[model samples]
Target: MGTAPVAVPHLPVGSRLLVPVLAATGGSGRTTVAHLLARGLAAIADTVLLDLSPRLASSWPTHLAARRATGLAALPPDQPLTRTAVRAACAVEDTGPHILSDSRAWHAPPLLNLPELPAAWYQLASIGGWQAVVADTPHPLAHDLLTARHTGERALTRDWYELPYAIPVLCAPATADGVHALIRATKTLDAEALPLARTVVALTGTTDGRLPASLRTALAGATDRTAAVVHIPHDPRIRAQGQSTAHPRPRTRHASTRLTDAVLSAAHRMWGRPMPLAPQPAALP
Candidate 1:
């Protein structure tokens, strides 16, 4: 059921990128990877991270509270978000992209009550100076945002918002049901609906560095849409650190350091600059 680039041809200088880390299951570590990608990408280019999901128990913004100047709810729904407002509502990370915290004002349903999402996305896309944007998205908006993209509606206000974006789906590792559930979820987004260039699946929750044969086999069946498959080793530090506010640029724990590197490789591929000799992990089943 569940899930998984790179280039010497990089995005033009100063161009913006959005990498939305999504998940089929609620607690599959989507936010964790999103934060790591944001941090890693920040090392290469100016990055901005938007947390679109507030329902989760923990997130990067929560880990380090001082950076949170405000939440997404404060972005004035009636009008386009002003740059000043974006600054006020988001936690500004000096070394990385700015962050927009999740807001409870989200209303409901298919759109998860945050109907102003499209406009919010446009505002971020419109903002200049940022080279990358990483969004930790929930299930409801995945289809909506990609639908806009497929329909050619998600361009930045200035450049026609054709902002570059990727969708990383994190699925539970080792469980057939989890991968199968992911496969079922993939059925909802056909190749046309999915971001073929940037779509990737990461098998999370692992104690070992390798993935189980069963999970790998399932992912291989999704070769059509997935760009790659990666494994994120489980570490207690990541779990513990989730409770506190994190550095704007994430610092890896003792064991999870390699996990962060693996994720950064994924980020590089999604950005379209191929990693020369980048080791190809196992293919999705």
Candidate 2:
């Protein structure tokens, strides 16, 4: 499908917003949510999409049709990570946010024995002068935290969730198993005393219409614990072709807009100040 240039919003005076979209399981639409959120925010401000998924499994490179393989992994470890260096590492998209993800060939040897710390990536993004950074995180720490046996390991993993600038966008599918996993994930967060008051829950619809009555009941109880819940409509194009830069259906676009508005609202309420308004795109008639 063809793409158009993404509209840039008027510059707003405020610290950059970091949105980390995370999920506990695969097929939870975490990456999709991150993509849409970044696209929406990119229309409102200068935004960057940071793909933190493992190199072999990453989708950003393919979805964005990035021409370069250079990304976070390509940055020289010895050099100071300045804004210019970070910008140089990104793959520019003609119709979306700058994408920073490992686009190396699948057959290439691994560059590092371990992934870079989340803090380092966040710091790099913070200094890049973008108004927002939408991070497609690998997975939630709840699962790893449950299996971790050592106190030090758990502490280090838990620290990843402690970013003050991050606004969490917890994603899950609108299905029985997905809802159940979300419950467990939330319970783990509560157990760790992590903040949820600023979280935005995204429930992606796999089928048409409302969720099953039983699932809705369970989801309602779970959603009540977060800042807000936004539903993503089922997009047949995406379901068939996977995530791409193709324009989504009207309903899906509306849902994405609602999610974006909710996130901005959460930021305003949390900081006790109104965020500079962006001229929103026209809603579906």
Candidate 3:
């Protein structure tokens, strides 16, 4: 997707954030959460969404020249990475966030130490002053990062959760599996690492905006876990089958926008106060 990034004489002055959207199960709407989160964050920073998903983000480039953008694997194994290389590998989008996307990196073996290897490029991109990095990392990688969030400590053995104050956004359905996933995810929480003050977005994907009874009981009874659940109603567009039928649909843009707003509201709980969100982009013509 190698479209040049907006050039600046120097790195912008501001804080940075790394949001790796994760999921316990397939239908938890992980990709949807990622794209929406990226869009939501665009208003606050120069957002670079790393599309590590097997499939590309719907808004990313798929054109002739854009498709020629290189993947992470193409990075020189030894030389230091430069802004030019970073710019070359990513594609500029027509609206919202830009994406440093390379699906090939999805198959590489996981690296135990982060801020380097596969993540280094993007991590460096963040360091170079993009301000915000939202990675739609593979589920396995995402889940492993959750382990760091759950324990509040990085395992002595892995690179998970190495990002400072990294926000781990976990998406789950409103079914029995979502409940089971909720319990399994929160079993171990380090107050210092993952606090209960923030909001949790649990997308029910059901007509009624309610979680399953069992999951509700589990979450409600979780006195130690204070992260309140913010339920997202079912949007048929999220579950659409084909590329032609999916997200950004005019019929469901309103629904997706609603969810984006919920995520922004929850963000305030963790980040201290809400950052002004840029207006939602009109659907692509």
Question: Highest TM-score among the candidates is held by which one?
Answer: 2
Candidate 3, position 201, lDDT: 47
TM-score of 1: 0.64
lDDT of 2 by residue, 152-217 (tens): 454333545565556788899988898999888888777777777878899998889787798889
Model 3 segments beyond 4 Å from truth?
1-13, 53-68, 103-122, 139-162, 190-199, 204-209, 212-214, 222-228, 241-285
Worst 10 residues of 1 by lDDT: 276-285
Report the Cα lDDT for residue 3, model 3.
Answer: 88
TM-score of 2: 0.85
Give per-residue CA lDDT, model 3, range 109-173, as digits (tens). 54312232334543555534566677665544335555656878653213324454345566777
Task: State the lDDT at 94 in candidate 2.
Answer: 57
lDDT of 3 at 189: 35
Question: What global local distance difference test value does model 1 have?
Answer: 0.53
Model 1: C-alpha RMSD to truth? 10.4
Number of the top-ranking candidate, with lDDT as the measure: 2
Error of 1 at 213 (Å): 2.2
